[model samples]
Target: MSSKQRFIKSVVATAKADAPAMPWARGARRAAFIAKRSGVEMDKKAA
Candidate 1:
């Protein structure tokens, strides 16, 4: 096998853990994530 194939084989050999859930799972986390993503200043008391 070529070097690329060897690299892919190595990558596939490793068992990675499941990815974490999205940050928007909670109300506060969702608000903060949305504010950061949209470049807006969120008011905590407004909600």
Candidate 2:
């Protein structure tokens, strides 16, 4: 597999693995995972 594909696979795997039990917490965790992996700052909270 290509490097980019491998990265995506790993990202999904990690996101799934780190998901929380609660639905709301799971969504937050998923968002955090995406932001962290994409190297984007999540300083602003959603209103």
Candidate 3:
């Protein structure tokens, strides 16, 4: 799988395993993951 796809799958797996506390954390992770994958920095406005 591609890095991006792997990242997404991992995030989903994590979310499923830790649903309660994973909501915000999952969002944060996804934002950071997306930024890293796209070679861009995450901005507060976008987050």
- All models, RMSD in angstroms: 6.3, 13.1, 13.6
lDDT of 1 by residue, 11-44 (tens): 7665354455665565776787778899999887
TM-score to true structure, per model = 0.34, 0.40, 0.40
Would you list the C-alpha lDDT of every candidate in the order shown?
A: 0.73, 0.76, 0.81
Ranking by lDDT: 3, 2, 1
Worst-scoring 10-residue span by lDDT in model 1: 15-24
For model 2 the local lDDT of residue 11 reads 94
Clashing pairs in 3: none
| Candidate 2 whole-model C-alpha lDDT, 0 to 1 | 0.76
Q: Give the alpha carbon lDDT tens digit for every residue of 1-47 in model 3.
A: 89999999999999889757554567766887778899998877766
How many residue pairs clash in model 1?
A: 0
Which candidate should be chosen as best, given lDDT against the real structure?
Answer: 3
Over 4 Å off in model 3, which ranges?
22-47
lDDT of 3 at 40: 93
